[model samples]
Each structure stands twice: as structure tokens, then as C-alpha cells.
Target chain A: MSKITSLADLKKKRDELKGGLDIRVKAIDPDSVVQVKVAMATCGIASGAKTVMEFFLEQLERRNIAAIVTQTGCMGYCYAEPTIEVKLPGQDPVVYGFVDLKRADQIIEKYIKTGELVDGIIPVNYQTIDFKE
Target chain B: MSKYSMHLLVCGGTGCHASESDAIVCNLRDELEAKGLMDTVQVILTGCFGFCEKGPIVKVMPDNTFYVQVKPEDAQTIIEEHVIKGRKVTRLLYQDPVSKEMISDSKHMGFFKKQLRIVLRNCGFINPENIDEYIARDGYQALGKVLSEMTPEQVIKEVRDSGQRGRGGGGFPTGLKWEIASKNKADQKYVVCNADEGDPGAFMDRSVLEGDPHSVLEAMAICGYSIGASHGLIYIRAEYPLAIARLKIAIKQARNMVCWAIRFSAQSTVLILNFAMEQEHLYAVKKQH
Candidate 1:
């Protein structure tokens, strides 16, 4: 992907993909769906999240998986470049550390395809604190 | 199944990449293959995992051993001891600057133990572009609920009640903004996400927009319905080329689902939607009350 030079080009590319794009809707049957999240924070990008994100999009499209790909800001784990979280509906979401194109492929093939937990997971570090208190 | 396996995830984030994270990745692959451990081990290059001060980081899987401040030269030893013999390289573990203890896992470290990730919920967990992974996490449920059972007013009420003040600095009540926009008499009102997050050291909105754009999209539509606006605008900064590109992709995806008709309006100025709520009508209604 070359640098997007203008908003018009951006719109043009979006329009071209419009017909093929598959945005996820709220699953009436949530049990059937899978969710993948890529960290797109500055830290993530400075870490190469762009490439990681692109790889997942391409793989998902090729595999014909009915999943929704999304981006989120920093998770504060800046040391873990290209972080990704996976949620296999009804199971707790797990955060995977240090993801790239190759790891993404394995994740898609193994975790997303076979539902087997693979390597590269960062253990839960923080406890949720109620800020209101 | 292999008797023993190790997966090495190398940090490919720009900072580390600039510091030869890519070279380190290549070297790891070469050394792993040279040691004939390629079949038993896997070396993967991944996006930023944060903790950027420690560049060229690697996490060995299964045991989840995190190694920080790795160099291209160290890849050989990592392959020899860690990958070949399954020995933990204690020297490479992340040492807390404060505690001075070599912390092997990110969870036990103070840097990772104090944050709550609601908006950043999915980052560093799944591939950013895979939707199934998102669906597995209940990604679009909010949008579905809003579209099916809740009226726009009800959606607005929920957001208002959720206590999610705008993360965009001003702390303006998001629900109230929707309420005002909903009351507006414009035939075409707009809902805008201020992805032009310009705060110093602030990448919150960018990460939300990047990692879980659907949440923002779902939230935006909920806002649109609440405010009776069918059109949406995302005012992202020009500085973030990657974020802009991803957001464009997200908008197209959103359109495919018929969630919202979105337009990317590129401008450097702070974005403020001109549509005003029908103030006179609200005041008149208040008078009647």
C-alpha cells in the first residue's frame, strides 16, 4: 500500500472496496462469532501494527471468516509491540503479545481456525480498579 | 505433537524496528534454522507491544517469558539456550527500573498492573483486521442492540447514564451532546468522532479508532440515532497517516453493514459540527411544561 496522498484517493479506494466489505453486525447468536482486536496506538504503530492489521484483513478475507477486525489505542503494554486480543465468544478475551504477519497467520489458522490457544500471550497484568470509588 | 516447542515473538514496532528489530528478527530466524530448531521452534515478528523504552523485545511462548532490550547479536544465544535447550535466559528479562528485580512476566510488573482497558480492550490480543476474532469478543453487540430493540432516545439515555464522558479532553457529556443534536431541527445533522486526538502523550482515541473502530462506530451510530442524524464524519489528524488509512477502511466496513453513512472530512482546524439543536423549540416546550 502506497501512502494515501489525498482524501479523494482514500474515498476512491473505500468506494472500490465498498461492495466487498463485510462489516460485522451484532450477532443475534453471539456464540458463533469470533473477535480480533489489534492495538493501533502510537506505540503499536511505532511497533508495526499497520502491517499486522493488514495481514489479518487479508487472511480473514481469504479464509472467509465472518469476523470483525477493529483497532484500539494503547493498552499501556508498550513493550509488547503489535499487540492483539482475541475473544472466542463465551470465553474470556486473551491478549496476545508481539504479533506480526506470521504470528497473525498462526493465530488465524490455529486459534481462530482450530480454537487452540497458541504461544505469545501476555499474562493478565493489571487488576481492574473502580475509579469512581 | 512436538515434545518441546518455543515461539519467539520479536517486536517490530517502529522504535524497535529503527533499532534493527527487523534485523534481530531475521537473525533469530537464521540462528533458529541454523541450530536445526526451526522445526521445533517458531520465530514471529509482531506489532508494538508497548513498553517501548525496551526496544527489540521478544516473548518466548508457552512459558510466556518476556525478554526486553534485545539486540541482533543476542538472537544467536537466545536460539542456543532458550530455543534449543529450553533454558530461561534470566539476564534478558525486563528489570524494573524502580524495583531492580528482573521481571519475567508483564503481569507482575508495575507498568502493566495499574491500567484498566475498556476502550483499549482488544489491542495486543488479536489481529486488527480479523473480524471473527472481534465477533468472538462481542464486538458489534452494542450496535445490534441499538438497531433492534432500542430507540434512538433510549440509546442516548444509555450513553448518558453510562458515565462515559468524552475522552476527547473537554469531558463534555457525550449523551448530552447527542441530546442537543437530537433536538436540533436540521434536516441533516451529523455525528462526528474527534479522532483528531492532538493531546501531547495522548494516543487514547487513536488506539480506540485503530484497535476497535467498531466500538467507536457503534457508539457513533448510537449517537446518530439518538440525535436523529444519519450522516457521520470522522475528523482525524493529518499527522497520523496509518490511523487515517485504517479509519478510512473502517468507514467503508461500517457502510457495508448499513450502520452509518460516513464521510472523511480532512482539515487541520478543530472540527465542530455546525448543526445546532432547535433551542427555541426546547425552550417553548419547557415553557409549556
Candidate 2:
């Protein structure tokens, strides 16, 4: 709350603020936060990626879920337009295809909340640039 | 849950500010308040996003939607269509010139796709006036790291290893220069910063000063500590009134940060501009403002 006057104060301030910034940090360390990314390229938007993104953004708040909802360029699932990648804390990411409003609701309710696998789970054909536990 | 659900980051860089970006912020806030979403949303004015071609850029948080070439009148449409209805205004999206495709994310835009930000990293992200925002992004962490962790020789060694060059006419390695200065023995030492860009349309130094003044101040203090100098003097031209004002504020703020590691007993090592600006140019820039 006060100005950081010394080295110890700077360290304390960094540690305090690091909690709020963990999600945006360049290094991805899986912890208590869930990450939900909506594919929002040209074809993805043509297939209602906007609505799906909005649902995730709003519903997560409504249900008191701690999540970071973001939009990425594309996940290369044009055939299954409006795909979403959800990674719960400490779990590998899962990409779901053909995600409509109903499917998005199921994701927040079943997959994200209850930790149950839902329908429409598309097998991810690619891996992230960095492999994490 | 956080009180605000979203943050609307608007570009307030000089180029965008001149293009009615402030008006866009006002209009957006008014529209949000009318819709009772003001409490749920915050509109923040930030420095340049480096895409001056697309002046007045508005970026929505959480989802990373970048709206380019935004106008004051478009604020209402942005609120109703994008903020409320959850749809991006197609026209405002940055359009790729080659294929004529609309790009929702700024990162994918060609202008920023390949660029790596060094000095301008926090320029567009944080409100320049706020020092706390700058600190949150590790603004003076390097200064602290040097002060608490390393000796002057160690600092010079690290800088030498990095091989960072000064952004001046002559490409001088900064560490070697500091090492040379530290090696010389003198009763009194001084670190002078040349902020004079005599050529017209030279705003690189000015932009950095305006957008992220703390960075300059921190670097100056580091230079002071490294060169065994007790005083730091910045000789800037007077035509840059905005930069001058920002530097004053930054210098004041940095002084408040007590030195804990090694006393920069360099008693408040601050020296403002030497007033080398041409009188005619000062009057011209003042009139333009």
C-alpha cells in the first residue's frame, strides 16, 4: 500500500503482486487458476466464437470460478469451428469442438466445475511449444 | 470475485491523443455508465501501443480483442455491440492488408507480429502517470537487483557480458564505458545524460521519456552507482516540455525510494535540463500543445 523504500520492501511488494499477475506471467506454472482459451480466427468468428467467448467470460464470473478466459488466433480446427481449449489447474489442456452455447454450459458445469469429461472432446493432434507436467 | 469484470485499455499516446482518443474514452465511459456497466468496467488510458498507423487503439481485457482506428462516435457501437452483446465490431478490427482479413488479436497483426519490445514493453500497457503500475511490471527491479546483489565491478561485468550498446550516435558499449569510468580515480565524479536530439522530428528519446520516465531515471541511477559518480545531470532541450515535466515527476518519485542496499550517498543525485533548446522551437512546440 505504501511506497517501496528499500530492497526488502521491493521484494515484499513483488511477492505480494505476483499473486494477481500469475495468470499473465510469461512462464506458465499450473496452480489454482484455470485457463480457458477460445479460438477466434476468421473462420472461428464466422462460426460464433464471439458468443462462445462471451459465455465463458460471463458465466465463469457468475459461478464464482477463478479462470482466465482468453482468445487465441486459431487452433487449426476449421472443420470444427468455434473450438475451445480448457485447462484446469494441474491438468493437461483439452480442446472441445463444435462448441455451441449448450456445449459451453456443459463445459463450465461438467468439465470445469465437476471435473467430469464431457462430450465433443476433440483429440488434440498437436502439442504446445513447451511440454509441462 | 473482482469488482470489475473488464478493463478497456485505450491508447493515449501523443499520436492517438491528438486523434480524439480522449473523447473516445469519455464517450465509452458515458455509454457504460448509462448502461449501468461503469462499475463493472474500467476505461484506462495508456501510452503508445507502437501501431501509430492505427491511432486510437482500444483493447478489451480478459479476451484480448483489439479494436483499431477507433473514433469518438464508435464508442457507443463498441459498448453496445462488443462490450454488451459480446460481438466485435467487424469494421474496427485490424484488417490484414494482404489478404484483407480482419484480425481480432493485436499480436497476430503484421505490424507487431515480429517485433520484440525492449524499452517500450511497458509503454502502452500502463498509464504513464502512475508509478505503481510501472513497479508492478518490474520497473526498478534491475536497480534493486544491482544494489542489493552485486558490487560495482560485478554490475559492470554483467553489463559487459550482455554487450548492451548506448542508443547514441556512436555505438559505445555501456558496460565498458562504465568500467573505464569506475577505474579512473577522481575527487568527484559526474554522470551526464545527453537528452539533446537537435534534428527535427527526433522524438525517440522524448517518447521514452513521456511513456516510461521511470526507466530512464532508474538507468541514470544505475549509471551513477556504476560510474562511482555522486551526481547525475540530464541536459535536455527545453522544446520538449512534456518530457521535461514527466522527467521532473519521475525524478521526484525515484528520490522518495530510499536507497537501502548501497547508499547512493549521491545526495539526491538529480540535475534537471541545462536549457539548450532553441527559443523559436520552444515557442513552436508550446503553441502546438
Candidate 3:
């Protein structure tokens, strides 16, 4: 409501607004939050990116973890339908293929929460980092 | 913001406000409250959503849905048809100017598809004038991190390792400069931020001070600490009045943070910037990662 008067007051305000702040900050600066991108191209949709994306949205927040889940064009992995990319803060973006709900859960538990790599990783076909994508 | 079943982001930019986005926000919140859905739904009055051609943008979060050209009267239908029934308001959906095809998700729309948000973090997500919104997003965490745990030499080394260059036309290494200043032994050293980019096209500094002012202040404090300077000064242009106002608010907000215990006399002053074309397209990208 006004200028923050003390450290205690600032901490209180931060906690009070943590939920909304997480939703907004995860998007603007996803470095600290888990960044998930669903492949939503025609091929991806045909494979079930829609279900995978929805499952991510409902489950990530339900698990009380902050994440930004958005749809993106094909990452050129057509064979792997319903592919998703997970980028942890300070880490390079990792693409996972054949993502059903079960794999999605494992991703949340092992990769996102525990920082342990999960299975379903697809090797990059080209030099994407050089393109500054 | 947390675990909300739905979030309605209404554009409160100059254009969308003229289109009565305020009424849309009020009505949407009313509809949610009337239906006993306030606990699950959040109505945020955000800045321009970048799609000025389709002003009065209303974005729904968690599902990543976009409703464009919304009216005050569309509130009931949005809540009932879209929010409650899980159906989209087809009439309010954004149509591509070229293809004339409706784009429901912003990620798929060309207007937003090619975009990446790095500098303009909180432009449309939070009320720029509100200090609380700024603090909510870990605004001063960096300053806290630097002062509590880092020595001046340690901070300078980290900056050197990060390879951060100047933000202006000249990409000078920031850490090298700080290391130089810290080595200069003086009773009263100084950290000066030369913010006066008088050129018409240079506006990154101005927009950041306006939208996410606290971040600039935090960085300034960190610089002051790293340079072993007790004083921080900002040289800003006066032509930009909004930047000036927001900088004052940011400075005031930063002063109230828990800096007294960590660092002494870590205060800052301001400057200005300008960029031409599409200045109000600040809210183009939703936090879609």
C-alpha cells in the first residue's frame, strides 16, 4: 500500500504476494523457476501435445511448484510426438520425447524437483545454441 | 497468483484504458465474486499487452488463453462461457490481421510467436506504480545477496566471471570498471550511473526504470557496494517525466528495504532514455517462458 518501512515489513509483503508474484516472475524471469515448453506444431498436436501441455499446467501448480508452461513450434523431432522441453534455471534447455502423463510426472518429480535427469531426452539435430534461439 | 483456477489480465495501458479496460476489470471481478469464485480467480490490471491493434486485451493464465477486443458487457459471458464452462469466447478471440484466422493461444499467434522478453520483465504483469508488486518478485534479492555474503573483491570477481558488458552503445566490461574503482583508495569514493542517453532511439534504460524500477535500484546498490563507494549518483534526462516519477518511487522503495544492516549509505539517484516506435507495446509477451 505504501513504501516498505523495514526489512520485516518487506518480508511480510513478499510472503503475502508470493503466489501471484511466482506466477508473474516465472514468466518474466524463468531463471529460478522451471521452464516447460510443449511442442504444439501440427505434428505435436497430432501426437498429443495438447494433453501433455494441459497435464503440465494443472499438475505443476497443483504440486505447489512454480513453473511456466507454454506451447512452441516443433523442435524438429517429429517422430517423438508430444515432446516437451524443460529448462531449469541456470541450466540449458533439455528436450524430452514421448511425453505422456506418466513421463510428465517423472519429469516433475525427478528432473524439476530433485534435479536428477530423467530418461526421454532427444539429441539435437542441429546447432541451435549458435543460432541464439 | 497462486493456484488460481483462472487469472484475468486486463490491459490497463493508455490505449486499452481509453477503451474502458477498467470497467472490464471491475465487471470481471464482480462476476467472479458474485459466483463465489474470487478465491479461485484473480483479476490483474496490467500494462499494455503489446497487441495495440487489438487493444483492451484480456489474457487468461494457467490455460494460456487470449481474449481480445473485450467489452464491459462481455464479462458475464467470459466468466460463464469461458471461465466456468471451459469454452472460449469466439467473438473475443484475436484474429490475425493478415490471415484473418482466429488465434486462441498467444503462443501460436504471429503477433506474439516471434517475441522474447528479456528487458521488459514486469511491464504488463504488475502495476508499475505499486512498490509492493516490485518487491514481490525478488526485487532486492540480488542486493541482499551481494551485501550479506560478498566482499567488494568477491563481488567484482563474480561480475568479471559473468562477462557483463555495458548496456549502452559501448559494451565496456562492467566488472573491470568496478575493480578499477574499488582499487582507488579514497575516503569518499563514488559510483555514478551515466543514465542520460539523450538520443531519441535509446530507451532501454527509461523503460526499465518505469516498468521494473526496483531492479535498476538494486543493481545500482550492488554497484555502489562493489565499487567500495558509499555514495551512488544517477544522471538522468529530464525530458522523460514518467521515468523520472517512477525512478523517484523506485529510489524510495529501495531505501525502505533491509539495506541498513548490510551496507551503509547504499543510496542511488536517477537519469533518462528515449526510443521511438511502438513504445506502448510493452505487454506483448505473457510470461510464457
* Highest DockQ model number: 2
The window of 10 residues in a row where model 2 chain A has the poorest summed lDDT is A21-30
True contacts kept of 1: 0.00
Off by over 4 Å in 3: A1-17, A22-133, B1-3, B13-24, B30-36, B47-49, B69-77, B127-136, B184-197, B201-203, B234-242, B260-289
By DockQ rank, best first, the candidates go 2, 3, 1
All candidates' TM-scores?
0.54, 0.71, 0.59
- lDDT per residue for candidate 1 within A41-129, as digits (tens), equals 77898889968877776677668785655555677789988898888878888899899788888999999888898889999888887
lDDT of 2 by residue, B222-281 (tens): 776776775667767766666676677666655555332122222222344222123342
lDDT by residue (B1-289, candidate 1, tens digit) is 1212345667654456578987887898888777776754656554456667887788765445689888899998887666544456888998888867778767677877786666666654433444434444655555545554566788888888987687654899977887888887986777867777666987667656555555666666667657776656777777765455555555555444332233444355323322212444223323432
Residue B158 error for model 2, in Å? 1.2
Could you tell me the TM-score of candidate 2? 0.71
lDDT by residue for model 3 (B4-100), tens: 5456778766567679998999999899989888976788876566776687888876555788888899999988776664567888998778877
State the number of backbone clashes in model 1.
55
- Best-fitting candidate, measured by lDDT? 2
Q: What lDDT tens digits, residue by residue, belong to model 2 across residues A1-133?
A: 3655556677677665543332333222224577887887788999999799878877986797878776666677899988998999889899999999999999999999999999999997875574222
The whole-model lDDT of each prediction reads 0.63, 0.73, 0.70
Residue A27 accuracy (lDDT) in model 2 = 21
